[model samples]
Target: MNFTPALPKPFTEIWREAYRYNEKDSPRKSSYQAPGKTPVPFILGTTKLTGGFSVDTSEYPTMGYWSNVPRNEKPQTLLVTGYLRGDNYIKERNTLIESLRILTSDEDPGYLELPLWGRFPVIVTNWDVSESGGKNGQCEVSIGLTRTGMPELQRRDTTGVMGLFNKLENTADSLKDAAVLAFESAVDGINAPDTIADSFTQIKTSLLDIAGRIQGSRSSLNEITGGLSSITNLLAQGERNPRKLASALFDSGKQIVDGIIKIRDTFDDPELFFTIKDNVKNMLQQLLGVKNFFLDVDTVTIKQQVIKEEAERLFKITAFSAASQLMTKLEDPTFSQINSYWKLLQDLEGSINMDDTNIYTAVQEIFMTVAEELSSKNIAAELTTFIKTPIPLPFLAQMLSCDEKKLRRLNNFSDSFLVEGEVIYV
Candidate 1:
């Protein structure tokens, strides 16, 4: 039930909340809520700061060694040069050292808040803290941070296409891990072999549908099918260990999803592009559609509840990732189609019927991406204007100031007059 902490805007909402994503002692808090009344400043004070941003890209051999797919936004990297000071040098040095220890080695990522850049969930990929005799009661520190994209039970927001993709990639990975954990938990709670076998059948059916849709895709279908086959055989042989089976299932699911994403790199065909994305999305929906009788029967067990919760989260996360890639892949997307994507996302949210605010955050970022990027190029592409009254075709000729024949052909008008004024697409 953890979320990336809510960031109203990168600079405006600089003061944010603090909560534990994995804390079991207390009921989980919303990622959108600001619980901490005060801001938690970095232990080190900055003297000078440096920052970076980049696009995550893959060179496509199929498109050509030099060609690449639409760039995914890379997490912004930070290099902060700062210092620690205290009345006692040893105490100040120890405090900074311990913070660095957790920053560098911990499995869970720690939050790094810059003065104006906004708070980020980050991993200290590399850092240095040093002290000298000349500089008594103080030490120089330089830290390198890469946004890990994994917010440990916190909400977050940032601007730019880079931030969107960075968070998306991490969220997708997080969703995968959570899905596996939930599946494993469910497997442990329900020991009935028949129930397990039926669930596996449902999984296989979903995978096969996806396999059929992507029949000619460059993705490795055989690999996905092969992994699932091995597990199905093992389950048939009375190998019912929950952990092992769940891990294998998780690997297979990830393999299929990874392969699906990889197919986008194979070639550029708009029709196939949408076909594959839609089919895979439908397969995921089907995967979620199957009713697990075991979950229903085991209502008394809380593990089942976790399984259901994770499934819902997984669904939304999957949709978010798919929408991100789709929007990015387009060279120039129209406001009409962008609006359609918004509708699809909204419908998805409505289907899930959960009151999660994080989905709306992702939606806003995507909508803004289209609006801001398109604003400068051609305002015409984004909006349309029309009248209810009928008008002659020659009326456009005089109004548009274009060559009459060309305008008429472009408008696809069969009659000499338009019954009602329409904003021509061109």
Candidate 2:
């Protein structure tokens, strides 16, 4: 009998049919699929591969024998090894050698392609090549690659020269404000009287008026003070600029002279006059002395030299004069006193130039000391009176039992006065 038994389907075909049947019966079919093409077995920048190739990956262990807890995983490292062979193996090897050299030399990481794992960005930590003695034209290379996870960013500049300049500018501005505030405070201190008398009140009002004029000037004293805020600002502008600081100082000095003139004019006005008692005359003389201290004898010449140090020196002198005047004004026995004037004088003296040091030490000391001494004595040689008839100074000195020269020294008199109604102090 030549009859053949019926053969079963091929194993692959039978498996496919069985799989189709199972897939229909199940809720869903498994959709797993294999990759379409294998990756090229070569580093992107290197020669073609001929021999067996391998890729190695390693993970650092975070687990310790004593601990059950798992720590975060570390970055992975890959090791690659391959060979090149052919008629042009030498040329190919040279190309690969050159490529490896370039990759290793760069600071930045490079891309790598593998036959099995796909492409990755990696750093070539180390690389080496070997050649056999036989001229079969083949060479081997091994490369160590580390995964470049997240790139590190560069740091920024914070404390540079520009930053330092800004800091200095701000500091200079603050110092300038502090100086202005000190000046204003000193002015307030001088203006405040311990006891309100008619003459003192008038003088205080006149001083306030003068201050008002200074504050209201085209280039105000306040603005001038602000001009000194920064050396840079001073060097820049005109009105509030550094170069104009001297002009502002000059204006201040002129205003002070004008104020003194106004106060002097009041002395001749009958409407402002009071009984010229010894104490009253002393107070008036002190007022005149204070006013005289602010007289700018050469403001025009001073304004020509717009130097910073000169302007600062002038300011100190003005402040000192004002303080001295205040000291004299507050010398009345009825006033509750303070030593602030003396303190301000000392501070100003330290700031002023040594060449200009004599005015405060000589003129103020001589007159003030004599006045204070005479005030302490309280020897009433004659009843306080406002005289209408003029008398000789010699006769008056004789009446007070004081030598004429001694009286002149004590009175700070440069010239003999027609004794008129002015009270004489012995």
Candidate 3:
């Protein structure tokens, strides 16, 4: 057999010795003595096998034993470390945890696969069976991979580790890309005058809304990492446990697809998907309310009647002057940075001629057109898609809303825009 045995040694004690002397920076040299010095078996030592596999040992400080190894039981704990070049440590740990947690007991332990030195693999165990009689008996039991039933375990674990590593690396790269893209998008939004309205208060509110939406999107993207981790572990065993593997893969895929659906759904129902949309709508409504109040003001008409001695009181309010002041406030450099529409406000006021009915109508139309232009394009498109294709209420309502009545409406709206949110006339 390729495996060799050095001598009978306490597994835990040998592991301790390995740590003290085997470290790269250590000056201590280990020598074997018949009785006084620790004598460990070759299998217990860090053994480099052919085919790029190495089995090793490590020792962690143990907790107080509930009951000591129990009367010559030699119930020892050794950190079994494995080093494999093209393997995944995290995946191995996860698989081993899943497969073996129900099987192994610390009080009377069994063997397990574990990481050593970053990517190394090791078998952990109590390593002694009193019933087996002697060290030879124990060593005999330890011989071959079948005893631990860990060859298949190793196969599964190796696949799992490699898959997990690749997935984690991919997720990390994706998150990095997301960060870069978000930054670029923000820069674009900041520079685009048409995207933001000029008015310090409005611009500030818009910036906050954009920031919130971007943050929400980033958070959604971050959730993919957990989903990916599950997929990696699940798919690694696709060849071994096709059914379970398929289930896991399916579940992960569903999560990603569901997230995309949520994206579409949230856009369609702005009030539901993002608080920012609600805030924007509210702000616009307030602006429209102000315009409506201005529209209601009574202006005196110029009239003269000789027979009836009709008289008219001329309300000489400089409407243009007040409008110019409003425009100037809107065009302030601070607000202009966010939006360019304030530059058109001057044209809006000049268009209003209270004396001419046609001019008055055109002026009001100009202002209304400018205000309507504030709808964000991206938000609008997402909303339109959401309105056309509503998400299933049974699936989404639990997370989106708690109101039963609203949930039903949301669900119905998904089927058809049988009901709609109000339209504010600018």
Candidate 4:
């Protein structure tokens, strides 16, 4: 075989041809960036990365080795190796060292980009630098990164996105006496036993107290309050009829939500929206907390139990209905809050028995409405975040580049206490 090595090529032309072939935007594989900061770019070498669905497993003592696995994932992490070298190796290395700053409570996370994998929002966990006097122009760095942003960028169609959430007819009537209808669905075919007439009488006081609380929510929403007083008369009608009592409580719940709606209708301030949501949430909690909702009877008969079950389920459905309605009226509620609200929806969904046609259908309608609302209103998902340990509100606000006062308005704090738990920022 005649070797083609007969033709010797100049190294300059060879290197130029290689560069011409590799000239494209994708040639650079890795970089780092902080919010509002320029990206720090560098060449990368071999990488050892570890990331996937995070899972928790529990080892159990059984004849067959088995582990309990929860349907949850831990945060993804990466072990990255890269290099920095040039004629000015020390300067380049120092520049990288400055770029990969130490992690701190108030520092915004930097992003890491890899060859094939997408860029990751990460806070540097730890890092090591390897150097030797002989290898003056080259050094290898290993870094650990815990990915952030569990509620990643929520992509949606922006075509004709305006008025998406507002498109729904403002028909609060669909929810009027929703509790009554839900309860009736439960006791529809099966008549309540005569012995059970006094079943939920114990909750009478709680119902009235909830109504009174709604009226006292604020003096500004006088229109909603004035109508709430009439619910007491409805309360008397409910005294003998558990369904009617639930309706009265529902009236209270609706009135509170309506008060929030009125506030949202009148004001554009985010604080007012969250304020109304917080107040209505309290009212709903009180209504849901009504004693004897599950019944106190020693032996719950099938008929009696059916009514009781309906009472419990519809009470939640009623409160959640009010919640879902109010959620639609909120302005930029944090995605973190939405996540918590989503969990509440899950609990409500679990409690509902599909066989109960009456209430199930009604509750499902509300579910669909809220799902749409979240899609339309999930604009602040990028702004939402959570912290494990306690951090000062001002510092947390600083980290998010948000105003401290505005942060307070965006989140519900029980008296400017420590801000250690889940936080939402608009």
Residue pairs clashing, model 1:
3-154, 4-154, 4-155, 4-156, 5-154, 5-155, 5-156, 6-155, 21-153, 390-419
lDDT of 2: 0.40
Q: Provide TM-scores for the models.
A: 0.39, 0.22, 0.18, 0.44
Candidate 4's residue-wise lDDT over 1-426, tens digit each? 111212223223453342234646235447776555666666766556554554434333233444432333555667888887788877767766777774522235677776555466677878788988887788888877776532222213322243344333222334434456657756766755442344444334444455455422355456665655544565445444555656665666666666655654565455455455455455544533432245565445787777766666655655566666655665556677677766765665566544434344445555665677677654555366778888877788888887787688767876485787677676
lDDT, candidate 2, residue 3? 14
- For model 2, residues 110-189, the per-residue Cα lDDT tens digits are 55654233344555667777888984677777777665544332111332334333333333233233334333332332
What C-alpha RMSD separates each model from the true structure?
19.0, 33.9, 28.8, 17.9
Q: Relative to the unseen true structure, what is the Cα RMSD of model 3?
A: 28.8
* Model 4, residue 68: C-alpha shift (Å): 39
Best by TM-score: 4
Local lDDT at 2 for model 3: 17
Tens digits of per-residue lDDT for model 1 on 1-426?
Answer: 233323324543323323222345332121100122222223434523333334334333234333222334455566777665667656655655566665332235556665345555556667787878897777777777665554433323443455555544555454445544545654555546554554455554554554555533433566557655756776778876655555555455555555556664563455575465444444444333332212222333565454444343433444444444444444344556556554565555445422323333334344455345445343224433474776776775676564566454335565666735665544
- Per-candidate local distance difference test: 0.49, 0.40, 0.29, 0.57
- Model 4 quality (TM-score): 0.44
Report how far residue 304 has shifted in candidate 3, in Å: 66
- Give the local distance difference test score of model 3: 0.29
| Candidates ranked by TM-score | 4, 1, 2, 3
Off by over 4 Å in 4: 1-182, 185-204, 208-249, 263-277, 280-293, 297-301, 382-400, 408-426
Best by lDDT: 4
